[model samples]
Target chain A: MRPTVHDIAAAAGVSLATVDRVLNRRPGVRHVTREKVENAIREIGYVRDVAAANLAKGRTYPLVFILPASDNSFMHGLNDEVRAAIARSSVERTAIRTLEVPAFDPAALVKVLNELGEERPAGIALVATDAPEVRDVVDRLVKDGIPVVTLVSDLTGSQRHHYAGVDNIAAGRTAARLLGRFLGGAKGEIAVLAGSMLVRDHRERLEGFAAVIAAEFPSLSILPVIEGRDDPEMAHMLVADALSKKGDIIGVYSLGAGNRGLIRALKEKAVDRSLTVVAHELTTHTRAALLDGTIDAILNQDAGHEVRSAIRVLKAKADGLAVIEAQERIRLDIFLKDNLP
Target chain B: MRPTVHDIAAAAGVSLATVDRVLNRRPGVRHVTREKVENAIREIGYVRDVAAANLAKGRTYPLVFILPASDNSFMHGLNDEVRAAIARSSVERTAIRTLEVPAFDPAALVKVLNELGEERPAGIALVATDAPEVRDVVDRLVKDGIPVVTLVSDLTGSQRHHYAGVDNIAAGRTAARLLGRFLGGAKGEIAVLAGSMLVRDHRERLEGFAAVIAAEFPSLSILPVIEGRDDPEMAHMLVADALSKKGDIIGVYSLGAGNRGLIRALKEKAVDRSLTVVAHELTTHTRAALLDGTIDAILNQDAGHEVRSAIRVLKAKADGLAVIEAQERIRLDIFLKDNLP
Candidate 1:
């Protein structure tokens, strides 16, 4: 039989009610008493019956998901996954709410995080901008006992408990290797389109891409990156302008969303199929373009997995439980038209 | 405020003890009395506080996962996901036990399913084979009040509560479109490598691939399918023999596992890198092959997502709850070396 609260109480030589309060992290328990109860729990190898314990406590994980308000397919997919999670909340017994701040607005996001601290939700999951204010907010949330998880874009050197997204550096290096080898030793200029340099994911991707290209394919040159802000019109204008200005451009890497604009630019120019086009995220637009030879390959991070991972981390934090790191590690998905899922 | 058991008992005009028995699904309450209590619960929209209720009852979900013993990367990935779930069992209040039977052995799989029924776990998740005996065994488990979910390959017309896999037909059609278009109106023979027609996923893939190739790329001829039983040596031998005999083969579609063999055959034969190759699953071998220009595109299903979906569905069904259909729907992932994750 599994060890129970009674065993913990006996081992700690504490009252049953006191043991319960300490186990639940409830108020009124002395620090020393709580430490004793925790030590007893560890000594006895007690695995709390989470379902039953939550039933007794009527616990509901109050989780907040912060995402960008960009209207690109990637953002849309992320929002849809979050909404799907919300729809399942009634059954999962979670109270999940999403907060959308403007894309690239670190100040607004920091403000929202500061406000959320007062509400004291069990956990917070956000796509962080690499800013001191955002990091400070995350640190405060952690200090206040709220677990913070970074989604999509990570905030390095913060108090965030976990990150639930793909490795951007690896993704970028993979993209560079693909482009270099696929062109069969051809020397040409490669153009890059990014959402913004401010976002860590985009910056990391560029850094990795450039490093690989410079190390492996010295013959190829990457032009200055065009910041599309992950907007279709901006991407389209920038790509078209680059193609016209640089007639020798032999490759294009759109490491951000707004692939709709990239596709439009490629189509308008009737870019040769041999140009080695690579983009991020597989949506209806990108999928069609891939089949039609407008795009050669796509790198994607499953939004659903990220959202689900965030919830699991949040719930575990809310319940004072440990999370399995291996399970929570999100993989970057690479897609070719032949292998589009 | 959430409704409590006391509210339910008072509303149902029953004693608290009677309400307790009904809420726990324990025996002793009359059929009519149970109906009254259930009706009260429904009218009040009272979702049992899962955490609190589980605490009071000391209930934990004992789940059994039945997977095929295949050494392919796909199966390995699926097993890894199950291991990840098992690692999470302590905190989630779930006891996960995995039972592996020989791959494609219907009798052995059926026997395991029957044995699982005897154990009477709260939930069972299995990759179903297309056999009536297997379906019958699953039906019996369902009848015994165990929530059963079909993982990866599903059993059609079975009493299983959920299927956590991609639509194989759509995956096949997409694969065909990619292959046909990538060939770019070139007239050539396409070789298809399959595991076996006995499996539903392989058969559906062939059907979808054939349908699209026939409709859109009539110029391309599909050669006879070579069944390698998803074994590397067999696939390698068959593919090498076919390449020797059919020198004009311009494309290859591998609709199942054993890609290691396919890669070996391609490399030994020194097949032209320009030949459009599409295969399923992005394993280490496929990823390397794609980067080296031996393979063009890969269609994939994330085994991790499928396994996680199976667990979520089983847990929800065991709780007598409905799942979010969109969230549970598995996606088809496409990968090219350029976009490899």
Candidate 2:
């Protein structure tokens, strides 16, 4: 049987109140009496239950999630996950609130960060833009003893305590391999689609994808990149324009959202020939495209998993507890039509 | 501020002790006074803080995990995850004990189920063998008011409260798609390696793989399945023999945890040619093989996630609380060399 405070009290020949004082590290216990209680506690193997103790002390964590207000399915899904977290906040003993700023606006993000720094929340999680001002603000938060976690698009050079997202570079390289293997020695040009070069995730993915394609599939040439800004209409226009110009394009690799536009363009232009397509983010549109073979495969980072992981990390950081890294590591999920869920 | 027990006592015109008695459902409180206190509680919207109450009551759930005693890497990883859970039991307010029965022995599994049912632990999580007797035992446990969760392998036609694993059929279909796409229009024989047909997961995966191959890739033919029983030596021998017999084998799909043997066999025989290999479970061996270009892709259901999900589901079931189905759903993860965690 595990030893309790009462057991320590009995072993030390002291009162239960004195033992409680010693256990809680409260004042009003003499050195000799404290030493006796400590010795008794040491004699018996007793591990204090941290969760129970926190509950008994009525502890609650106040956390903030800063997200980019983007009109993309993936960002909407991420926001939905955060709202789900809020719904579960009472049970988890956390007061979670979300702050949304304009997407891709580093100055707006920095301004919000400065405002949050004044209040000093227990922790902050944000989808960061890799700008000097944003990095400075993140470092300031860490310096002020507020744990910051970069969610989704990470600001790697910043002092963010953790990143709750997949490695974009690896995801891109995987996409390249899948596209290359699926095409199988077919000599044709491959077109690349991305949200913007400003976001670190997009740029990193492009770098990885280009490197793999150049190293492994030298037969297949890559066309110039099209920056879609993750806007469906803009992506569709850009892709349609590319397809109209390049008659020999046989493959398309989309390393961002705006798959709706990509799908529309494929439906319109690639009707003559079946093109091998690999896309990122499994939204309703992407799922349907995958089902109908318009898109061959999808590389996904689950927004729900990312939000939940961020919350867990923030809670652990607040308590100075070690997280189970294996459990917390976000996997880059590759999806085909067969394994949709 | 939220209404506290003090406010309930004041509103109900009862002493603090009487309120405590009513709240705790202790004896000696009159029916009229109990109704009054309950009415006061309802009037003030005073939802009981369950975590604090559990702390005061010193409640700890004793959970039992029944696993297969197999030397396979997946089983070892599962056991290690359970041990990690046990290490974290105190903080999570759970006492986790593991019971190992010999692999593929339904009688031994049934015996352990009977013993666990007799003691009636708060919850039971098991990698179930889909036999009538095992299903009956699981139903009996549920009828006896015990929560039962089927882990890695599920017993479908049973009253298990939850299944904390991926859909095996989907996983198999995924493998078929990957192999079919990677081997792109190549007319050659594809070999299948399974643990056993008696296990429902293997059977389901075989069914899915066959269905997809028959419908989509009629060019590629599937050979008779070789049951390796998830033993490394047996798998290696079977695979080597198959490779020796079939001169035009271009692909291999392993839907079980015998990749070590399969890898050895492939290295010994098929060293000159690159075969499209799709395997299940990502252990250290599989990860290394993937990085070194031995294994092309892996379909993995994370053991750590499964163990943690089972515990969460069990605790929720024990408390008769609703679970967030989306949060609890285990994902089927697809990993290539580049996207490996």
Candidate 3:
């Protein structure tokens, strides 16, 4: 039989109240008595049921998820996943609330971070707008004993407890490799579309893509990056303009979330020639594009996985517990039409 | 503050013992008293702390993981994942044990299943050896009210409660797509290697691969399958023989384990010409091979994810609770050298 609080009390020859005091780290217990209880706990091998203990003590984690107010399928999916967590908040003894900041607005994000630090939620998980001020505020929050985790877009130099996302650089390299190999020695230019250069994920992805193409596929040339701001119409316009200018463009790599625009442009230029395309995220648009043979492949990070991973990391951090690193590492998922789930 | 057992006791005007009896579903509780206690529980909106409640009731799920005693990287990895679960068993309120049966021995597997059914574990998760007798045993166990989940390789047409693995048919189709795209109009024979035709996963994968190749890439002729029985040495011999006989083999799709043998044969060939190879699972050998350009792509279902998902499903089934279907859907992961992790 497993040991319990009563077992520890009996083993230490102390009153149940004194045992509870020591277990809960309550004040006013004598040092020797506390040590006795601790030793008894060790001897009896009492693995505390943390959830039950928290319930008995009437403790609930107040967590805040800060997401970007971006009208994209991926962002919408992330929000839905967060809401799913909220549905289970009562059972988990957590009070989770979401705060949306304007997309790509670093100053507004910094201001929000400062406010949250003052409010002092038990934990905070944010899709960060990477900036020095934002990093400073994150550091300050950590210094004040609140656990902070970066969501999809990570803050590289910040003192964040964990990152609940994929390795963007590797994702970019994978994209390049896919596009390069899919082209199969065809000599033509490749067009690149991204959300923004300001975001670390996009920048890192571009870096990786450029590095791999330079090292491996010297035959293919990458055109100037078109920033879509994750807006589909903007992406559509940029892609259409580029495609029209460079009629010999053999491939397209979209390392951002404005796939609707990219898809529209591709459909408009629906010629008999095969154009290799790779994009990020699996949304309704991307899925259809893949099915119709427009997009060759998609590199996705599951929004649900990211959101769930964030909650688990934040909870573990709040409780000073070690997380399963392998379980928490959000995979860079590559999808073909055949493997779409 | 949230309601506790004490709140329920007071609200129902009953003793703590009465409340405990009702909550734990213990015997000797009067119907009217039970109703009053349940009413109090509903009125207060008390979310039962299942972990704590189980602790109080001394409930621990005894689960068995039946794996194949195959000396292959994937099987070893699966066993390691099950061991990882066992490491957390104490804290998770589970008693997990593993039983290994000889690889590909359906009769032995059926015998083991019959014995386990008699032993009457709370739950069972097995890498099923597909056979009618095995299916019968699974049905018998389920009839005896024990929850069973098929892990890794599923037992189709069985009474297994859940399958914690990827869709192998889709995996196969994805492999064909990758190989077809990578080969890009090259007119040469493609080699197919599998673990065994007896297993459902292997059969399904072959079916999918064949269907996709026939429908899409008619230029590439498929050579007859070579069954390695997931043995590396056997796979090496068969691949070497096939390579010698078919010098014009342009691409190879290995839909099962024993990649070590396949890698050895490829290394021995040392051809200047490129052989576009696709395989299943990501092991050290496969990772190194991918980096060195021996393998083009890898289709994997995370063994860790499968084991964990199976445990969650088994536990939920045992408790007659609903599972989050989306969360439990194991993704068919595609890996390139750039995205090895």
Candidate 4:
């Protein structure tokens, strides 16, 4: 039998109402009393019966998902997946609202997080910008007893309860191995195009890629990173500029969202499609490029899976239960044109 | 705003006790009374409040998962995921039991299904074999009011409520496009290795692969299909034989499991890793092969996701509620060594 609220209350030598206030983070509980209740909960390992408790309390978790206001195919696909989740919210007894923030703007993200903290939804799921101010806001939300989960891009060293995305380091290492091997151990230059160095995902990917290339494929030399900001025009210009500057490029790794610019650059440069090209995410643009031989492989993290995972984690945290870790851990997906799903 | 059992009973002109018996399938209600109550339920669209109803009745859904007894890494990973779910059963208020049947044996699968029918678990999840006998057994279970869901390999024309697996047709098409483009559009013969044509997944993959090859890359010729039955030794022997006989084979697509054999054959033949080879599932063998250059791309369906999805669908069905289709749809994960999670 699992311990319940009554057990925690009894163990803490407190009333059931007091325990409820502390557990739900309702007002009117003293700091000492709240600490006692939390201690008792930890000691007893009292996992709240989410489904049953929510039924008795009539609590529907109100969750907000914040994403970038980008019009790229990947962003549109992500928005679609979130909308699909919203449509199913009624059945799951959840109230989900989506908020859009400007891409790569720390001030905007921090403001949104602060506003969300004031509203105090049961939980917040956001694609975070890697900035100290944004991290502070996320910490404030957690301190205020709201569960925060990072989706896609994560903010490190925050009080966020979970990250519902892939391991970017592993994804990058995998890409380097593929590119190095596909190039047949040839000595050549590899070009990397990324959204931005400020984003944690991109940095981690570059780190992993560089680590693998240095350790395993000493023959290939990687050029300085190109910042595309995940904009097609920027990516095209940067890639084209790099190709013109260094004509010996044998491989390209786009560890960012937008691939349209990269595809356009490759086509315009008339770079042989046989040159190993690996990019991140599978959208309409990437899919078409992959099929047409412009893009070789794609590293993807399923948006639908990530959205669903966020909801599950938020609901679990709101109900004061531990999530199944293995089930919640999102995987890095690799796609070739042969294996596109 | 949802209708309750009382509304159903009132609309059916039946007593609450009779309605309960009919709703729970307790075997006491007369046929005419059951029909009337069911009709009323259909008219009212009275979706049972699963959480509240379970709490009131103190009912825990007992779900049985039937898996293959193969001792491969993929199967082990699937089993591990299922076990993780089972460990959370107490907290989730579910009773999950796992039953393993001999791999590729329809007789054993049918026998197990019959036994599950006799045991009458609240729900059953099976990795189906494409056999009529197994389908009949599944139909019998569904007829007896037990919800059955197919995992991984689906049983066509059966009364399975859902398929918690990737679309194999799409997977095949994706593989063909990848292989064709990866080979640089060179007109050469491609060999397809499968577990067995008797399995619906393999057949669907072959169909899709053929469709794409015929429609898009008419220059690439497909060699006769080789059935390895998902065994390492058979795959090794068959692939080696095929390679020896067909000297001009430019690409190979292994749509089934047992990639260990495929890797062995490639290594034995001293075939250059540059030859386009696409296989399914990212086990240790396939991952290492991919990294070392023996395997070009992996078309994977995350075994963990499949197991978890099966459990969710089963629980939802047992509760007499609709599942979120998009949330439950398993993705075909494309993996390269560079993008492996």
Best by DockQ, which number?
3
- For model 4 chain A, the run of ten residues with the poorest summed lDDT: A332-341
CAPRI quality band, candidate 1: acceptable
Model 2 CA deviation exceeding 4 Å by range: A1-48, B1-48
Question: What would the per-residue lDDT of candidate 1 be over residues A1-341, giving only the tens digit for each residue?
Answer: 57889999999999999988986668999889999999999999998876666655667788899988888888888999999888878767788999999877889999999999999988899988888888888998899899899999888789899899888987888788767756657789999999989889999999889988999889899999999989899898988898878888899989998889989989888445457888888899999998887888788888998998899888888777777675687877666565565
The Cα RMSD of model 4 versus the native structure comes to 6.0
Interface RMSD for candidates 1 onward, in order = 4.9, 1.9, 1.7, 4.1
Ranking 2 against 4 by DockQ, winner: 2
The DockQ figures for the candidates are: 0.27, 0.63, 0.67, 0.39
Q: Per-residue lDDT for A123-240 in model 2, tens only?
A: 9999998888999999989998898999998986888889999999999899999999999889999999999998899999999999999999988999989999999999999999
i-RMS of candidate 2 = 1.9
Candidate 3 C-alpha lDDT tens digits along B1-341: 55789999999999999998998789999899999999999999877766666757678899999999988899899999999999898778889999999977889988888899788888999998888888888998998999999998888699889999999999999999899989888899999999989888999999999999999999999999999989999999999999988879999999999999999999887466689999999999998999999999988889999999999999888777678898899989888889888
Clashing pairs in 2: none
Better of 3 and 4 by DockQ: 3
- The lowest-lDDT stretch of 10 consecutive residues in candidate 2 chain A is A45-54
The alpha-carbon deviation from the true structure for residue A117 of candidate 2, after best TM-score superposition, in angstroms, is: 2.0
Once model 2 is optimally superposed onto the true structure by TM-score, how far is the C-alpha of residue A232 displaced, in angstroms?
0.9
Better model by DockQ: candidate 1 vs candidate 4 = 4
